[model samples]
Target: MTILCYHSVDPAWESPLAMRPGEFADHAAWLARHRTVVPLSEAVNRLDRRGRLPRGMAALTFDDGFAGVLEHALPEVQRHRLPTTIFLVAQTLTDEGLDAWWVRTPPPWPLATLTVEEVLHLRDLGVDLQSHSWAHQDLPELDEDRCERDLRQSREFLEDLLHGPVPFLAYPRGLHDDGVRRAARRAGYSHAFALPEGPERVDEYAVPRVGIHRGNNTRTLWVKSQPRYLDARHARRHVARTGRRLLKIG
Candidate 1:
């Protein structure tokens, strides 16, 4: 099974990493055309079922709980009758001033963010809301206590907001060490997502994901779905690392 991860979809440009609204719609349409798009829950449940998923079995997932998800992306997803999972940073669901990192970059664009109310609204729309963290920070970089707070508090807060168990988690910046993964399990998440270099199988703890970045077009997406393509990608990484080491020795 392939789990595709996205950040934001907006008309107004903010970062190169984000997808434009039209581009995102096109990706969704492509999935609808070629694959059996399933809900994260169903995919998890049917992991052991052999040959059940067709050639193009893909699941949609969005991280960072951007407002564009509720504003623009959800409608397109609903139109296609596709299920999506969104991981939210509990602290970002506010209209407060930009965080410190935003100061280092260009002035704040009118980036839409999911407010607490908007999250509730999306839940009503049948979107699965899960925890990203209290603040979008790299868990591996944080101490154990801080990691526990981010994971535990975020899940607790969202569960209270949605009035049920939040079963999924996407690590911020795709950063997780062994300790971070253990922290997530302890925090009550049934599964977690990582930016896998290739396609994913059914694993509750370390589900691999393919990131859809700004440069990803239809051809690139197709290429990424192939297992051989993943093998070649890994091989290229190996070659690059070997060359870097050789140069250092020289």
Candidate 2:
């Protein structure tokens, strides 16, 4: 399954994470023509089975519940009738400011998050909303107790808001470790996503995803979506790790 990840789809800010609305529409249009884009749960379930999906099977996932996703991205997704998942930072989803912790204090242009009402609207529109975390803090950086608490609390908050089992988690910043994965499983998430690269991923809890960034247009996305490219990326990463070990590079 090619689980493609996206963040904000807006024209307001140009970020590595931000893909312009038209660009996203182009990507979605291509997927409609060429791929079997399923919901995140379906993708995870098929992944658990390790069964072969239809030709060009892909899934669309978004990290951080950006307002632009509802405003811009969903229209394209709706036009294509693609099943999509948006992982929400619970605190941001509920906050008056409606922005992530880091984005609240920062530096760049203001980061936008989905309003509580918009989140409910998304649910009404049949978009699957799940957990990112209570806040967008990096999971691995926290202690185990804090980590588990964060994961559990995030799931709880989302379930409370959406009134459904928040069973899936996409690790904030795509950051996770063995300890964090253990915590996620303990916290009752059936699946967890990471930016790991490879077929031989660490475990089911650390499912890898290919990120879609501002630089990726239709052609680049198709290239990145191919198995050979993903396999080659994994091969290169393995070689790099081996070299680092041999050279004692920290």
Candidate 3:
């Protein structure tokens, strides 16, 4: 099964990486026509039992509780009766505004984020809410103490708001080290999503996600769904980055 990750669904902003509402609608329509869209929990349960997913199964996930998700994405999701998981930063839901990481860009680009009320409303609409982090910091870069605080505190805040446990988490920037993974496990997360550039074995922790960014459309999405192509792409990127680092050092 392939899990597609999205950030925002707004088209007005020219970031092709963020799927526009129309593109999202089309993707949903395609999925409804061609794939079995399952909830993340059910997918994990199946993986735990049989070590394989049913044919044609796919899952949709959104990282960050962007306002555009509530405004644009949810409607399309609901229209298709699709199941989706959303990873949210608990602090972002508060009135204090988005973290610096999500807002490092110039004005208007970083201005879109969901309010607390909008997040609650999305919860009411059957969206599976989960934790991102407290301040959207890179978990692997932080010390153990900071990592633990961010992971546990974010989950605690979300659970308190929703009155239930939020079992899933996506690492900020899809970054994780051994300590980061350990921290997530300690925080009681059932599963964590990583932007690993391809599909991965659905373990109890560290499930891989195919991040959909600018320039991803039906063709690229289809290519990413295949394990062989995805693995090759990841290898290429690894080599490219290594070469760049070597050049810098030289």
Q: Which ranges in model 1 have alpha carbons more than 4 Å from their true place?
A: 46-54, 94-110, 197-203, 227-229, 242-250
Q: What is residue 163's positional error in candidate 2, in angstroms?
A: 1.0
Give candidate 2 misplaced runs (Cα > 4 Å).
Answer: 48-54, 95-98, 103-107, 197-200, 241-250
Candidate 3 regions with alpha-carbon error over 4 angstroms: 48-53, 103-110, 198-202, 227-229, 238-241, 245-250
Global lDDT of each candidate = 0.71, 0.80, 0.73
* Best-fitting candidate, scored by TM-score: 2
Kindly indicate the candidate among 1 and 2 with the higher TM-score. 2
lDDT (10s digit) by residue, model 3, range 144-246: 8789888999999999988888888888777776788888888878778777632333455677677776557676766765544545765776667645432
207, model 2: CA deviation in Å?
Answer: 0.8
Q: What's the TM-score of each model vs. the native?
A: 0.84, 0.89, 0.87
lDDT of 2: 0.80
The local distance difference test score of model 1 is 0.71
Structure candidate 3, residue pairs in collision: 16-214, 17-213, 17-214
Worst ten in a row by lDDT for model 3? 241-250
TM-score of 2: 0.89
List clashing residue pairs in candidate 2.
Answer: none
Top-down lDDT ranking: 2, 3, 1
Clashes of each: 0, 0, 3
Alpha-carbon error at 191 in model 2, in Å?
A: 0.2
